[model samples]
Target: MPSMKNSSFYPSYFLLVGIPGLEHEHIWISIPFCITYAFALFGNLMVMFVILVSPRLHQPMFIFLSMLAGNDGLLCTSFTPKILSVFWFNDRAISFTGCLLQMFFIHSFTSIESGFLLSMAYDRYIAIYNPLRYSSIITSRLILRLVIVFLVRAVVLVGPCLILIKRFPAFKTNIIRHSYCEHMAVVKLADADTHVNSILGLLVAFTILGVDLLLILLSYTMIFNAVFRLPSARLKTFNTCTPHICVFLSFYGMALFSFLSHRYGKKIPPSIHIIFSDIYLLVPPMLNPLIYGIKTSLIREEMGKILWKH
Candidate 1:
């Protein structure tokens, strides 16, 4: 363990650059970000409201959808407010502890969201392939257990990275180039050896995200095989999966782009990286609920009822 007694080892604060090379345009950039954040909050909350109040949506699929909405809300809330503050008020100073807390919540919610997507894939698989056993296999109790498991896994995996960061002798600088406190971004600023931290972070990413993605793909493959055999229900099954597929692709596609660009796209402009990094967090939360609302008949109906009542 590194010496915590060394006064220089720990940083008191960090400066977040809202978007590198676009300082002059921050006010303009905030307009879209604000809109997206509001939409994400409203849309996800509406999804949760519909599911909670409407007993008809107590099915496994809708239950999972509610979980996704909740995760989206948390995910968006984790960093959007601070980023917006930076853009609007030019307040970029964040305490070191505050940054760590934000990093933990952001990454943990991301992992949880990925886990929820995997669970939703399984839900779709069972509903399409084994409709008879779907209810029995995917109960409220089971959903609760899965939620606990995902939350625990995220915390356990991310907690150690924080510890590792704390052990570093010092950071090269207190400036984080990105809008948020991502693990790698913060780690790269450290003056000490970061081999363990980097390797551990990569391992965690692969173990959680890589495994969830593989399982999701496998589940979908099995679902498609079963769907193809059913001539009468093939179209219905495909339609049911459209929203899930869309959300999955939107979330993972942006995530992969951001990850690859950060690690490998050295020649890419900093502005491009900054923009995509923000988009990766913003797009999924904003789009997931909208896709579900438009594509899901139950949610649309509930929304219609609410609108009429209002």
Candidate 2:
């Protein structure tokens, strides 16, 4: 809430958060994220294009893939520019309002990603458990409804949380250590008492991470129970889910690592903590579609067809 007029930290403060004494080393971070952003953009765009152009890939799985692609696209775009700005421009300071908006959109797409993943898991469960009715169950109408539900639920859930974050008057240090506007990062900068924000964030995390993981686990449990009863054909069916399983493991495992490190691993170097935290945030969105594309034969073949046709 307090402003230091014409200090050496002034320019960087507007772009990145500056601690009173420490110099921000931002240029070192910019190069890698730029490269990662290019790859993420290309990979997600290709996934979207393949789904859009290939009628053969119009099933529930691909439909969900499209949704994931959309989420990844928004996630990368939403966070990357400000992250790059913090590094490239030597600016970590965000306006109170800009910070709040960034946090809201970040949560929106993140919640949507969680919801979509859960939906995908359920689709897998139905397809594996009752192959006889897969076609009838995952109709276009149902897919549309599911997408609407994810969008609505994400907005409803994050809306109030954002409102809570916005009400806090800027009080303490403005320097956010990490690149983008994370809920925790923004809340940490608050000069006011943040007990309420912390509790609300914990609730949101539980709702999104805990609930989504619970459903995914249940879905897998049912799937495995059903999977064991089937013959060799079931193994082939399970193979289709290998990439998704990989994504889930990478995404959630890294998330757990980051959360634990941030909350409990105080002994670790801040740089190490920051790197792992960014990995949890950035890697999965960039890699999930690529994994799906490679693992799903239909997507692979369709991508090939599109490439050749183009």
Candidate 3:
């Protein structure tokens, strides 16, 4: 067997050179990532500022929007540097513990994001179906409680799951064939059978993304029914949902593609897999604030006011 020290010779398996492996190292792609990163950071930060500094945005709608923006900010920050390094410096190497932490945070933030989306859906549902009771239904105390529940679900679930994964012995190659440390990428390098890990991972992903999405869809279905019942109010209610609808479709559509591709996209071109997987993480953060902020007049006006002040 080749010594671990000189193990870089297996360049053929480098087909995807990193997790969600790629055909070739398109280092030039960093140009676009840099642009997207800048935009996501700026847009999310602006949303946070507008919501915090402007008292008008302190309502449940903007409160959840702020949380969503915060999740996007942290989500992108968690993996962008590693991706940038891989593309720029060929620093594809990642320590085992570092990979574990990356997996944990990525999964955690993803759960939190899904939870926030659910909260937003509920907010809309209440606003439309029970406008008079909406305030009481989604009070400050209840919002805080929901936030805590959402965060707890992510941290508690992901933390122990990572611990379980770390129990496996690391006898095989430590190389991850992807831009960033991903859950499956790390497991693929395991010398031991990872069937249990894979099963658990899928289960957890289903609970967080799959189940949350179903609930979100149900919430929207109810919201749509309520909106349709109000003949004159349909336009205004639909306008209110346009941004969330765009975000929901983009977030879930790309997510499903990534999940399905990772599972069954093995025969497909590695380049396509890489690009699609990247979009799963990169596109949502880049467009979320724009969809939720710029598309809404209130958010846009508040952002303008904050910018003008500062």
Q: Each candidate's TM vs. the true structure?
A: 0.95, 0.90, 0.91
**Residues 1-310, model 1: lDDT tens digits:** 1113233455788889878999999999999999999999999999999999888888889989998999999999999999999999989989889999999999899999999999999989988888888889989899999999999999999999998987788877788889999898899889888899999999998988889999999998998898878777556866889999999999999988888998899999988898898899888999999999999998899888878998
lDDT tens per residue, model 3, 95-209:
6577778888888998999999988988888888888898889999988999899889998878777876677655355555666767777677666788988888888899999
Best by lDDT, which number? 1
Candidate topping TM-score: 1
Per-residue CA lDDT of model 2 for 1-310, tens digit only, reads: 3454432221223234422122355565567778888778889899999999889987788888888987888887877887776667655567767766777888888788888888888888888888899999988999889889888987887788778766765535555666666787767666678898888888888888889989999999888888888887887888877777887887788877888888899898766777776667678888887798778889899998988987
Model 1 spans with C-alpha error above 4 angstroms: 1-9
Lowest lDDT sum, 10 consecutive residues, model 1, at 1-10
Who is ahead in lDDT, 1 or 3? 1
Inter-residue clash pairs, candidate 3: 16-21, 16-22, 18-177, 18-178, 19-177, 19-178
Question: lDDT, candidate 3, residue 117?
Answer: 90
Model 2's number of clashes is 10
lDDT scores of the candidates, listed in order: 0.90, 0.77, 0.79
Cα deviation of 74, candidate 2, in Å: 0.7
Q: Show the colliding residue pairs in model 2.
A: 15-91, 15-92, 16-91, 16-92, 16-93, 17-92, 17-93, 17-175, 171-191, 172-191
State the lDDT at 158 in candidate 2: 79
In model 2, which regions exceed 4 Å deviation? 1-15, 18-25
TM-score for model 1? 0.95
